[model samples]
Target: MFRTEISMLAACALAGAAHGQNLADLSLDQLSRIEVTSVGKRLQRVADVAGSVYVITADDIRRCGATTLPEVLRLAPNLQVARVDGAQYAISARTGTDLLANKMLVLVDGRTVYSPLFSGVFWEAIEMPLDDIERIEVLSGSGGTLYGSNAFHGVINIVTRSAGETAGTLVKGAVGTSERFVTLRHGAASDAGAFRVFAKKRDAENTQRASGAPVRDASRHQLAGFRWDGGTPQRQFTGTGEVYHHRTEDVLGERDYHGAYVLGRYIEDAGGRRTQLQAYADRLVRERSRTIRNTVDTLDLELQQQQLPTAGMDLLWGAGWRLYRDDAQPASPAALDLLPRRKYLHLWNAFAQVEMEGAAASRFTLGLKAEHNAYTGLELLPTLRYSWRPSEDSNVWAAASRVVRTPARVDRDVASPPLVPNPSVRAEKADIAELGWRGRFGSGASASLTAFAHRFGQLRSFDLNGATGVFANNYGGWLRGLEGWAEWFPAQNLRLKAGMLLQHPRYDAAAGTSPQPPSVTLGNDARHLFKLGVAWDVRHNVWVDFHVRHVGRRPAPAVPSYLAADARVAWRPAPSVELSAAVRNLGEPRHVEWGAPATASLVPRSLLLQFVWWP
Candidate 1:
């Protein structure tokens, strides 16, 4: 049945093309029109944003044949995405690429996903139905002025489709060499609102160690979620909730985790003024190992307002409050423990940004954020930006900002076999500057280039005092880099994109004459990175997508440089049915992307077949 349907579509497309009816071409203007909200915390044209930003659209996701969020992220050339195993990934931007990359912030529909326990994301535990995602906005620079602390390097925001747009039934299934997944979704529309519910399950096999042994990293996960949207465009209300359970078996032992969250949002626009209020609550429990367990609960509330107070002037402001309660314990005496078995943390923040048109075809933006955290009494983040449009198709921008990464629970409270608590640890800070240019040539080409520099202080390190190790802020560093990308469309049916990155990173002790501890190490720093992608619409209903990436050798842990390639071919038999096949890591059978002692298993080449049905 599937083959027949696809064959029918192929024949139709061939017939139509032979009749001189060409498919619509995707122009540069259309691509630039995609609006993004992560840059300034409000909707803005992608071309108008004064930062290094990239957008992964729904079409890009479908054509890439990505089964996980990190796989989808690989399309963004500005980001460094590495797979550690079947379920774990390490992702960052510009700098600090490691297993625990704490400087980057990640959010799903305005809800933060970074765990305060370690200030890093547990990628394995965060799962969502990929079909529901509308777009992902990636900003490769500091967003501290608007997002507050921990936005020191970059920010990623994932947006989902509106319930009204997904009013139907969808079922999808996939089987691959290493994993199997299934998803079901149902949506409905009523006089008062639109709602959708979805569920997904996945199981993955283990990977092989460098020594050619199975790593025992198999995993399984299940997730369910729902979303509801109501009211008119002028007065809208949204409610969403999700729950998930995951289990994994690794070298250490078996681990289990489960979590749930609910969010409510209300928005109103009257007389050219817009207001938004949001609230959310979440709880999580994790058995990290056989002898370690932790539980956390969080409640957050926020209010925001946006308006065009005057011609050529735009302003947005918001305030938020968050509370976190945590409980941790060790089942065995040899396991790690928190200084306080139970603890509570409070956070309050307010932020504002104003944009105004200046003389000489330029725009200026000023932003500031004031935040108070339990560990850091008070902190201030500020940014200034200027953008100049020399022509209708070109833009030049510059910006400067101050950002910080606050101490996490493990930094100041952890006490275990190898880590000792240190109450004196301070926040890591950086002063960043950037300049960029973006241009569009004719209707078939576009390009962007950015250069950035950063000065850091109060970097985190370990202090060994006669066999006991304690965390401290005793190191500093300087980082400079260049990132650029170009896109070309030689034919209406073909599109190509290429990107490159180069960086120089250095670190040293803040206090002269003090030797660095052996435990203190900089993250995986790649000096050069390159990526190329191609998307060809073979026919009106068939497409082929291919990507190639080359990562330079990293310093610590010493991962040799490697090149990887991925390809996917997809066919849409009807408006509601699709079939696709994909191959990943085609360049090498198995290779390690990260990890020392070579603990991380090698990422193996895999092939998958997928089918999607919507009615």
Candidate 2:
């Protein structure tokens, strides 16, 4: 496989040998100047960030030919993403995969979307037109000091383009063996502001089980959203809203989930000082039966400020408040249900960070945060970082941080047969250290490498007593990993990107705990992952891209290692229209990326045709 990838790259290079300029020249330049805010809570050049971070640009998204957000995220080497079925994905950073992944924090345009019920994201419920996405930043280390709780392992921040940038009409559609979807969007400028509205509908076929029998996982999605941006550069105001309905069929029967949210943000920049205020309201409803339903409502508010307190120094501070109200109803006699069906969860946090520049292109940063939650009264997170630039286009950085994950409702309030929750369960904690380097070898090539180690305490576990078990904090472990990625132009019109991950995790159950191994209870994670991609400009108007990835075997659930490949070809028949064809899971016909053997859904090779028109 490695030789095959190398041969493909060599072939692309030879094909583009006559071109004058490499396609990666401009991209490499833009990458160095790309500003990211996830690390310090303020805009900073990628080279200046003191932690491991990967940025996926808009151009990459356009060329990738992916229909869903999760598919696009595969470009980030720091992340581990697996498709569970037609409409579900298990994603994490620096760790293996989990259907109920809870440690990673995800934000869409500054709005948190993870459910408080399980402290995990319901990917099917979060949908938006892909064209509006500007960039995605994947931070592979802890962001507890600035991002507050649930940033235990990593953070994914999805930023959308400003309304003004999308001032036109766009129609997109796609047909595939596994799914079909269409989207419509229109944007215009009025006296109030620049605004755009979009609507999308999609349907997916059920996946097959290992035995070739169809599973009950088919789904349908309907989504609509709008964004409006107003005011001047010195004082900007933005408002956004979205509503969605998702329906899924499973063994239990058909279920419908509806969600809606409204958000507003105001920013003031004056005299080298910036201040931002944001607020949002969100609601989610899931209907199984007339009497069995789950509903969650949330209200969030945040304030942030950035200033150059003195020469060669930067200061940042922020505070946020969020409230989640969950009303749940048990489905049947054996379901694990939250006691006191209606309950409220409140979280408040404040954080401050300071960066000081030193001699010889070096910087030092210190950050601290204090958060108060319903389950954990108060938690303190602190971080220290240093970065040194050895050359104009290279950076060496190191960071150490403390992060905590507070207990979710499932951990503290559940009361059901064969399971019991303990309100006394403490928060899960981890101390992480990271060292990384990012540099450009030349104008046409760049690479990033990071080494990280984590020491965890009070990890989630269970204590079996007689006939039932209670949630407890009796697991601790050490996890160490190395992540590396590189992109280069071997020819003027060809670009190659590759990445790999090596992870080692060791966990031990505390004395007197259940005898089950930690891997069996805590979920299984793959130890190695590799990905390679190629983009070749076959002609001025035709482009082709190829991607191949490998995932190592998992132990607990006993899933064997697998390799998958994908390819896309795009043609621009006119300036305003594009037509493309994509094949996913190529070469490998049927394989399972997750779940137990008997019930796991098999992902099959499929092809799609897509069209986009701008008028």
Candidate 3:
């Protein structure tokens, strides 16, 4: 499955350029111009967000030396991304779980991608041309105020660029010692609107040699889409759609999935008032080596309004709903009476946030979200925050929020005798409180830091009997951590970015914890993790980046400690062609994250070479 015959190639002209100024030369004023919608779903500078967040742009993805979505996720300060063999990855932030992972809600274009089967984002199947991403917003801790449900620990928003913004003809392909990747992007504009379509394919042999080694992970994506803009920016309507497919090798067997989706939204602003409506539906098929297969279809809709009903106060509100269904395989007449499956269960939610501006240097925010789920019934999430800015250089803020982890389909099905259901499971709950600081110095540097803790109740896990797929209540646990990050680009060419994180988790009763091995340090969580990277511009058109990272160890999980680093150099040989090469995991064994001791890791040292042509 070679996308291109790979061979050693020198860095393109971008990396060949002579170095005079480094990325560190860029001042604070310059970096503030990058547009971000991660915080409030509105354009604002990165510094405006009240919590610890990171923005990974398309360029950053290329320059960071990564191949898959999991690799890109590693850039987040304390987030852990560990590969389970070739296709599966155990990913989590701050807190780790044994039976079920119910933290971290992941969204693609505002659509929830976590499976109701386990309350975790299947990190796999998030296939899209990396080049199409506008930016990735990583928000840590209790985003339940807006995202609802499993947004217990953190939130990841993967936003794509508009077809209109990417109008052009581009082809990008890559080759590596053990893998190959390629993508094609083309766009056009007409009276109806601007449209762009792209396709990507990747195949890789095992980096490590062994039968059943979890290598040979292969996947492909076919997406054809267009955005039709019908009116002005303030009053506009747009639509887009895509079809995609993905296949991966896993521990049990391979799972192939194919799907299509279409989305449309309309916005209107009149008399200082604004309103919006959006809807989308997607269908996916899951085919496993086993005889049983499943098909899932999801439908989503949203409506929102924002206005200043009274002076000095701003009000924003929105409601959303999602319907999900998984059709089971047809059975013989004898088994027709087995547990029946339903095609739909409505989840309806509404939220409103009010921001009050106070005189002098203070502001206040009050918000709440209410949702009704068939499994866990009604849930209410609330948030309260206050901020004060004494001077242009600094601002301090604090917030308290309540979040819940709604029960998933797995909570009921998979009993020991097979399809029997468990009716006693309940939702996991959490209470979070945090304080943060944002500051900018006249000397041209800025930073953000957040200190937070979470109290959990009714955590779910497999029953001690372990006889059924059913899960039951586990005693409460606690998570506390500190996250801080900063970016300094003194110049356009040279940039320095760094992040640090620390966390500790305490289980109230060590007795009944199922899979945790005896070696785990009591109450000891993952230790300190750190990240540092520097991007330098060398001469004419050459740019080079070096990144180094450290992953600490933790309990029950035999996750080994490791230090790994990656380096990349890119050159623009011509205005239309660029060449690049990168190396990953230079100094460590195959690694993984957020899994029980049984989780496997299948990775070896690897290399990647790619070419980009934009005309």
Candidate 4:
């Protein structure tokens, strides 16, 4: 049974790392550190965060039992997840250069999760409850001077915490051999503040090497929220609500979905000057055989005042209004407007950031972003970053930005069959540059390395709409890449992490040159990748972990590259009881990338056994 749940979580992390060091506690690599918030926009520490960041917590998603969310986002190795069927998923970061808007930019607790009707991001309608998340700040490239428009290839901020930091009431369950699960979480606090709720259910039936294609996977998710850091935790007011549903097995059968969203946030900081507010509402519906419905209502309100009447300089501005609707009824009624078409998207953005601390350690950051979109209305995204810490653990940062990618609904309107619509489209822009260097040696662990170059202009592909339909992005392309990462704790119970990525993409000659299977560089890129992980402790209440991933190998439009390994263990024994077991694709070779062909096979090995109870 998956190696007996990874040998009973390695005998409960070596019986709690043999008391790590009596008289108190502090094992697990000395309680670990180096948090993140995807660089710029707050939450630092990753060696002071000068760029290129990464953080995934919640105890690394329960020691990596992964169960979805693209397997905990493929444990970030510069990200590049694929599985295009059965609840679809296709995450990207770094290269293949975000086909017509791949340029990453996602948010869950902060709203904004792709989809303007195909800017894409339906990662199975996001259920995120991976233990009520509390971190996930992956930021590799541009953020348009602080998140403004399709971030241009890097920015993943999925933050969720506060419920008084998981008050109480918890439960967990699991099954293996292809996958099965159960989850629940609850929390509470008094003084009119703090609350939490979570739920999860999943079913599995993997293994279907094709025979008319079938995987029939099942999925379910739920979440609830409430918070009242109540003025003083730097002023606050937060609210959240989420709902999701899933169904798999496509082609004439399974293809169901359900979605719901609600969000409200307000945070204010007086002495340090900081203010913010956000609003959201989303609804989605999809069913088998051509029934699609989408609704979006968002009001992102922002206001910032920092280092205000003092310090160096900093300011943030915002204004948003998005209202989208999609009916898409297609049972063939002369194809009424051929379905899929509803527009009411509006956006207006304002940004400003200036932090200059000249001489000595040097520091300079000037930012600006102005946007107006409703299908290319107005735009001006600008930003520049400069840093030079020279010493104090080293630091060096460089940045340049201007990004945009708007126009979905199949780029204006799609009608299945082949593709359609092109409402005079024009919304594809990229001009990016980034350089990074972050450090923290002295055996404390921390490292970073970044390199980027983007220069795109109006890129989209697919055409010829009548004779049976077809129309999407009549062609355009160009991309580039390079990435690096590191983390180490040398001794003290271990803690290691590593990453690497390199890519190249093209076909800008208007993509003419005839066709045969040309989508230029094919469905985003995945050049070369490498990832490694190790987390020990192996003693005291137990804890054991290991991860290894490698995905590389490509041609014009064919992907096949593999390597996988995962293992986990955890045990608490008392004090509310806790137990864990994990094993995923351990040595289960065969791999492929880019989704949709029933997720392109090769996913075997799976197991999980969990139990939790709280005080």
Candidate 5:
């Protein structure tokens, strides 16, 4: 059945490619001029951002042939995205490569998505309809002053299209060796407002171990959501809600999880000034191995204002409050347990940023944030940045920032079988400095390079000297790296992008000269990384894209270097229809991207066919 479905989709794509041109065949010149908003919280040309930033547009996402958020994120050069199983992924930026990477902050439409339970994101539990996403903005350096704690290394903001922009019906389906997925959506626009609703379902097969045995990591997921946008010309209102359920089978055992969230926002713009009020609530429940069950509920509120207070200055300020509650229960007495059984957390923060444009094309920015949490008292974060524009096409920028990662539930309250609580754990902090340059050459070529150094204090570690293991902030370290990417459109129809990263990281004991753990599993750092991508408009309506990536060896669990490649061919047969075929992991049958060598499973190659209909 899978083969038959894929064959039909391929046939349709080929037929469409043979036809005439379509709107999807946008010129490379137009794409380079796209605008981005994450750098300074205001819309600006991509080439003008002073930081190491990357933008993944909707067209780019369409050509990548990715089925999940993690797969789509692989396109960003600064991120390390690793596949752990059929439904799990380990992703981070600049530092850390663990199953629960906690250094990077992620937001979807202004809503934070990380779990306070582990101070990390559970990739498998977060899902969205890919077609609804407008763009993904990735900042490869500290953003603590604007995003608060946990934005220690970087931030990823996923922005979705407005309801008015999607006023139609869309249906998408895919079948492949690894998974099957389907989606249905409808949108409508009226004088009063615009609304959209969607439903999606997916099922995936299990991966294999090195011995060619099935790992039983298969999974299934279902998601439904709705979005509404409306209001008068001066006042704008937006509301969104989603519900999801997921089930997975793994080596440890079977797991079931469900979650729901609702978000609302009101924005007003007048005379070069803007104000926004936003609120959201989320609830999640999980059952693992038939032995452990956990539940979490969260409510958040924020108010922000932006204004051009003076001819040469721009000001942005915001305040936010959040409340979180967690409950854990083990089916068996000897199973997993959480201290206090039930816990409540409260967080409050305020932030402000000022940008000044000086004479001779120079700009300076200063930002500060203060946050108070239940575990940690008041913490302050500060950042300073300067940019010099020598010409319209070239820019030089530098920045210094301080960031922190606050303790999580696991750090202060976990009391599972072999682990004990440690209420004394403090927030980990870092001071980072970065210098970068961006330039646009003749024609459609552009490049960016960045060098950064960071000194970390109070890093987290696990101590096993006592009867039960305890988490502590007992290490310090220095990390330095160079990262860059270049893009070129050699021909009118061909485009190429290449990126590389190199780093050196070292750790030492806070007190004595004792040797640190040989297996630094906390933040697995890789020394070298590289990626290359190519997109060619082979014909009027046909497009082909190819991507290759290499990740160097990591310490601790000792993950060896590996190379992977992907290719996709897409065609628009009609103005309202598209079809594509893709192959992932073309270089190898299966390989382990992360985790301990002894128990790691292999991620296998996959062939997929997809179709989209809009009318």
Candidate 6:
């Protein structure tokens, strides 16, 4: 398998070089100038942000041959991504990875997608057409001051293209050793605006346990969505809706899940001031042969404004409200259950940020947020940041922040035996400090580096109160890490990217108690990680890409260190047709990224062929 992949890569690279015509869409300098809106809730250049961030462009996603959002996220070096099974993944930034990682916040076109029940994203429920994605901005640091609560560790914002940009018909199909999928999209232009509708279906085979026994984790998914873009630049309006269904098999039984959502937004820009309002409603349902069955309905509304309040000063403020009504039922009397079968959860938050320019191209920013939740009445989050531009292509930044991870329904409502709920549970807290630098070396290279230290308190731990095992806050710890990535344009048509991360963490009991596995597990992390990637647009219509990653061993549960590689070759035979072949997990037939080795599911190697057409 390794030899075959290498031969294919060699041939593609030679062919592309012989037929090369133009450089990739954007140059190194142009990439630095790309505007992003997640760092500070306002548009800013990548080189100007005072945080640790990485941007994955549309071209990068296309060349990587990743059919799903989770797969695409692996391209960002700032994140730790693990394939748990055939249809499940564990992803986190600057923290431990888990099946239900709640520290990271995810947004699709500015709409929150995290679940209220677990305070984590259901990756299986997010089934959007990948072809419409414009870009993804990944920030590997706390965003609580502006995003609030669950935005404790990091944030991922997915931006999609407008209807006008996809005004045509598109069809895509892919078949692999273990999976198959098909998608269709159609768009049209109108006097008022443009509109598009799309649908997709996918099926995946089951993964296997260490003993070669099938895990029965196969899955199927179907999704449909529509979007409309209207109005002018100064006063724009947009609306979107989506419906999806997914089914999967587990060791215990089979499960079916479905959901639908609709969202609308209006933005007005007057001179140097901007105002935006958005609203959305969503419903989700789950049915299972075992475990629990549940339904959740959500309503959310938000308003924000940005203005140049004075000379060399900018102001940004926002407010939001969200409500969730959840109903749950257990499959059996002995199964786990949430008390008060029916419950309502409400969240309210308001935030403000001020940025002022100082002497010698320096800038200072202060932000604060006050948030209230059903479990925790009110909490305050604050951040202070400063940046100095020593040159046109270099920036030095530092920041200090205090944030908290509010309790989720699962944290305080479980009413099953062997596990007792604690309604008085307090929020987990963190105090962080960071120093970073970003620089562009001419048009051929660019780089970013950041060092961070986080002090944690009131961490969740399992406590034996008399005879009952109650969830409690009895642990504390500290984490310090260094992360950085660099990009180089070795040639007009060839680009190379490399990144690395190194960290050290320590944990202990609050005082007299001994350290528990649950407390140490809070920072179950890899000591170091490294990644390298190559993208060569050999020709005007041919491309070759390769990615290699190395993860150090993890403690506690003990996940062995491993190195993996992926390669892809694509060619456009005509103006409207393209074909690609890719291989994942090259050389390594199977490996486990999470769970105990004896019970962990193995991720298998796969070879795939894909076709895309625009007619």
Please, what is the whole-model Cα lDDT of each candidate in the order they appear? 0.83, 0.83, 0.67, 0.63, 0.83, 0.83
Name the regions of candidate 4 deviating beyond 4 angstroms. Answer: 1-49, 52-54, 57-59, 63-66, 70-117, 125-137, 140-149, 152-154, 157-287, 292-383, 390-400, 409-411, 415-422, 428-539, 542-578, 581-615
Please, what are the lDDT tens digits per residue for candidate 3 over residues 1-615?
000001111111112121112344335654444445444444445555555567676656767767778788888885756565555666666775322345788877666777766677656666667776656778777778778887887888887665665668879888997678788888876666667777777776643332334444554444455445456656766676778777776444677777788888787878777787888888877666553455778898988777845777878888999888866563332332113554456789998888888877887888899998878789999988777788866778788999998877656654334234667878888898889997776754677788989898876655444543445556577878888877775665667778888887665643655633212311224567888888888855677988888768755555666678888888888877888899877776454443443434446667899888987
lDDT, residue 539, model 3? 58
The root-mean-square deviation over C-alpha atoms between each candidate and the true structure, in angstroms, is 5.5, 5.9, 6.5, 23.1, 5.7, 5.9
Candidate with better TM-score, 1 vs 3: 1
Candidate 5: lDDT of 224?
A: 98
Writing each residue's lDDT as its tens digit, candidate 2 over 80-110 gives: 8888887788898976368778888899989
- Give TM-scores for every candidate, taking all chains together and pairing residue i with residue i: 0.94, 0.94, 0.88, 0.32, 0.94, 0.95
Off by over 4 Å in 6: 1-22, 519-523
Worst 10 residues of 6 by lDDT: 1-10
Tens-place lDDT per residue, model 1, 413-496, is: 988866788889899999999999999999889999999999998888877776787888887889899999999989998889
Q: CA lDDT of 463 in candidate 2?
A: 75
Angstrom error at residue 154, model 6? 0.5
> Candidate 6, after superposition: displacement of residue 226 in Å?
0.5
**Model 1, position 600: C-alpha lDDT score:** 62
Error of 2 at 534 (Å): 0.7
lDDT of 5 by residue, 1-615 (tens): 000011232223322332322323443334445565666766666666778888787766777889999999999988888888788888888777778888889999888999888888989888788888767888988988888898888989888877876778989999999899999999999999999999999999988878777888899999999989998767889999999999999767888889999999988878887788899999999888857788999999999888956889999989999999988887875656787888899999999999999889999999999999999899999999999999988889999999999999888888765778899999999999999998888767888899999999988887775456777887788989999998887787787899988888777776843334724435776889999999888887788899999999877678899999999998888878889999999998888887775678788899999988887
Instruction: Give the per-residue Cα lDDT of candidate 1 at 159.
Output: 81
